[model samples]
Target chain A: MQRNSKLSEMAEVKLLGVLPSPYVYRVIWALKLKGIPYEFVKENLSNKSPLLLKCNPVHKKIPVLVHGEKSVCESMIIVEYINEVWPQNPLLPNDLHERAVTRFWSKFADDKGSSVLKIFRTREDEMEQVKKEILEMLQAIEDHGLGDKKFFGGDQIGIADIAFGSVIHWLTVMEEGILGAKLLEAHKFPRLYSWLKNFQQAPVIKENLPDFEEAVAFYKGLREASLGRAASK
Target chain B: MQRNSKLSEMAEVKLLGVLPSPYVYRVIWALKLKGIPYEFVKENLSNKSPLLLKCNPVHKKIPVLVHGEKSVCESMIIVEYINEVWPQNPLLPNDLHERAVTRFWSKFADDKGSSVLKIFRTREDEMEQVKKEILEMLQAIEDHGLGDKKFFGGDQIGIADIAFGSVIHWLTVMEEGILGAKLLEAHKFPRLYSWLKNFQQAPVIKENLPDFEEAVAFYKGLREASLGRAASK
Candidate 1:
């Protein structure tokens, strides 16, 4: 914890999170985009840490970014905080209306972008139902969210893209490995499918995203453990 | 629709919302406090207006604030948009960390504060479970969300207070009227109960909050209709 001293004028960022987490990855990409250097502490979610608990007492969830002496929790909030603190490569748009639209999609990302949780908990008999829900969510974003723009906000990658990166880019890894299904079937959602490629190919995003094979292996283990817990209970 | 023209540049704030909606009230209170004048177009929730659908195509719900031709959806997002567009009576905090903390509470208000939705839909068999969940949600806020401050941010009103207004103050109205249950029993949640009093008495809040008896009657009707629909289905 670097107290606000003259020497500590420079923001010292320390990110507390677990890997293969889209929420965690969102923060990672935001930091990398702004080119803010930080130390990343991978946590053991099962055991938890005192620092993690102390940083986020309410939820005690991860992706807590400690800047100077303060901790910013929640991934999108952290990203926004990072953007405000370092406004170099502006993650959000310039126009007030565009900024509001970016927020609308950002909230959508949290509300609907968190579809992976529902997908993970899908019942064996209700697989089709869950798939339908996921597809509808994807389709809505594909049709309205992306349009024919290169990114969600057109030309540049902004908040909405960062918001969906975890759900689309990272969770796609989970969908393929754990569920053995393709979430963004290119034919079904050409825009979203194309958007994912462009998002991954972005200079900062391409560099910051986690390793592909590692993510697949990690998600497979996570799904098995999650299912095993449900079965036991 | 006031396009972004100099002729209509007096912050043309038009709120599209339905009454007896705490979500709508959140935006109303924000606008009033900022002393921003605006027009209100009441909409029928069941039969939403084309303007409502067009503005919030994704959610298709209100309170949507159409500010200078651009529309902002999601109540808290609308409030934040208001804050950014009109920085008169600042709703959010100054410090970056405090802003993040304020956002965390706002998200908590959305994530946990909206537990009333689940409580309203609970079955007779799951009544106790739902009640316990609501209690736990309330207890977390009571224990942590408030201190010796006059409001959630401090002595002055902040975004968190506006965020929780829907859950604590307004939802309490619904809880007693619709559920025949008293959630904010003074003895059970002293902090929350006290906070609600201060929140309601704020100049902008007191004057702007919907008529009390009318809200009660409206909610009672809504709950009956909602439950009736659930039963028929």
Candidate 2:
């Protein structure tokens, strides 16, 4: 077992992820935050790479982090591995309860925040339902997730912040695809909106974000294709 | 907060979960294994109770575990919370690497195991696709998840075991709901099938599982309702 300092230098870390997925971006941000150099292999979700299939055959999904030969799947689990492998900038809190709370919000973001995508492919009535869900999610996060703290886990940015940071930022860009604006409006969720701004300004996040124009264009194409399929049906 | 001993005695740890959901059963098995006394509040998912809504407004879903004023949502998160609040029979390994592996499989089970549900709801062609996914997931677990180890982590049943145990067991019942029998053929996935048998016999799991007849009847009702909805559409 390698210690933290040695693992950083010795481990050949590689990330297999797509370009635009917020889940993949969480791993990228964490690796960059820890100053761990890694080779990035972009995967086509339509035709996943053999390495991804081998590493995570259960899910056969991206954001699979390979350190040396050991592969870790699931976005947040990869982030947690990165935290343990290279403990320079800690991603989790020291207190057990605080850590649990951070994990609670992080898991919440991963599970519930997928509704943003649902808003994109859905029709008007379904989109309204998705909008209500987004508001309730944002409200829960605003009430239980953040207080006066700059990040989800006190002063420094941690895993929970990384989880939610990617979510709000990407969802904001996907707003054009939603067809109706409701939850992310500044008045309704002012603190989260401000947090979004603050989060994007962070150095690692700002440097690593996907090109905004391209992401919007991609989502637009996806929405069109989905609607086309529905119409044909 | 409260110390572990005090929590075990005074607090009532009630699990709010639906019968058909494997995710809910993960928490149930964990609580039972720990020898913690608790109440089970069975939820009618179609008409959610005020308590379920109040406890988990964010997702408004099971399985929510309520301990005093605190409520934890999401299945695996609730299991982890149970592990923390009751430290006697540890579900997760103490070693960092082993913990990461346990988490890796737990996440795998949560994300990939849903393919079984897809088979239950979809038409023949879509069911074939979902069956392919289910086979791949089962094979991966057989090859990578369990080797010489009796359980996922080691000799003792751990978090990964609890997570996948419910899925694999419930998948058998769900198979009766589906049109085909492709997931766990005795010839194809012998190791996984054997593991399933071993998992069922484990004392904690065997005692706490829902009655087999009831589960089959419940799934049959769900299957009929889903088919009816599809035909109506």
Candidate 3:
């Protein structure tokens, strides 16, 4: 077993992630927030690279972080590992209960937030259902997730904030692609909307987000391809 | 906010879970193994109970275990919460690295095992692709997950075992429902196959599992409903 501190300084930290995945973005935001220098390896999901397959053979998915020879898979797990190794800018609260609450919301973001994409890919009727779900998701976050705190963990951005930051940012792009409108209506979700502006303006997040026009264009192409496939079927 | 031992004797333990969900079965197995008595609250997914919605307002999903006043959502998170609260029968390893590895596999199982269900629900041509994914998932587990151990954490049924146990058992029932077989063949994945048998026969797991026939019938109904909806479009 490798000791936590025994990781070699000479060894490089390599992150395997695909563009546009919120899971991948969480890791990037964490690394950037902590000022950790790392090499980013872009993965093509269609033709997965050999290293990605070997590193994460079980899932063969991205957001695999390799520190020394040991590789950790799953986005949140990787973030946890990074927190333990870095320990400088803490992403999780020190208190166990607070940590548990943060983890609960983080897990919620992961398991539920993916449904936002259904709005873009499904039929018109199904899109309406997805819209309802998205509104409910935003409402829950607005009510419980942020109770007048600047971030999910209060003063500073923590794991839960990072988790939702990716969702809200990417959802804006997806909302534009699917509906030609923003879903995080500023008036309806005032706290969440304000937090979104604050979050994107944070130094690490501000520097790392993908170009708006490029992301919008990419999702537009994806939407067209999915619609074309649905039409043929 | 609640202290650990305050609710130990005075509080009641209640589990809110859907009948057919494998995620829910994991909590049942864990609680049963610890000899902790609890009340069961079955949830209707279509019309969620007020308690279910109130307890897990973030996700509003099943497998929410309410201990005293606090409710924990997400299956593995709930299992970990159960382990922390109960501690009589340890579900995770003692060593930190082993614990991390166990967690790694548990997360892997949660993320990747859904492909088996995809195989059951997909079109005939798509079944082949899903089958390939299922085989890859099984192969990775057999090679890296089992490795000459009686269970995932060696001689004990830890979190990884329980996570995968639900998945492997449900895959068997799904195969029977679909009237097709490919992945988890004894000759191909002997280690995982044997582990599956051992996991099913474990005393707590054996007693808590839902009837195989009932599970098969339920899955069949689900499969037909999904296909019917798809065909209607």
Give the Å shift of residue B218 in candidate 2. Answer: 2.9
Candidate 1 TM-score versus the reference? 0.94
Candidate 3 per-residue lDDT over residues B101-185, each given as its tens digit? 7888887788888886675578776777777777788888988898888899888898999999988998998888785664679
Tell me the spans in candidate 2 whose CA falls farther than 4 Å from its real position: A1-10, A17-21, A35-54, A57-61, A87-89, A94-98, A114-149, A175-183, A210-233, B1-10, B18-21, B42-48, B117-133, B176-182, B224-233
- Write one digit per residue (lDDT tens) for candidate 2, span B50-128: 9999887767889998886567788888888778778888998876667888999888888888887665577666676
What's candidate 1's i-RMS value?
2.5
Arrange candidates by TM-score, descending: 1, 2, 3
Alpha-carbon runs more than 4 Å astray in model 1: A1-9, B1-11
**Candidate 3, superposed: residue stretches over 4 Å from native:** A1-11, A18-21, A42-49, A94-98, A115-133, A174-179, A211-233, B1-11, B18-21, B33-35, B42-49, B87-89, B94-101, B112-140, B174-183, B211-233
**Residue B81 in candidate 3 has what lDDT?**
73
Top-lDDT structure, candidate number? 3
How well does candidate 1 score on lDDT at residue B76? 89
Which residue pairs come into collision in candidate 2? Answer: none
Compared with the true structure, all predictions reach lDDT values of 0.82, 0.81, 0.83
Model 3 agreement with the true structure over A133-206: per-residue lDDT tens digits? 88888998989888888888877889998888878888998877778777789999999999999899998899
For model 2 chain B, where is the 10-residue window of minimal lDDT?
B1-10
Which one wins on DockQ?
1
> Cα lDDT of model 2 overall?
0.81
Per-candidate DockQ values are: 0.64, 0.30, 0.27
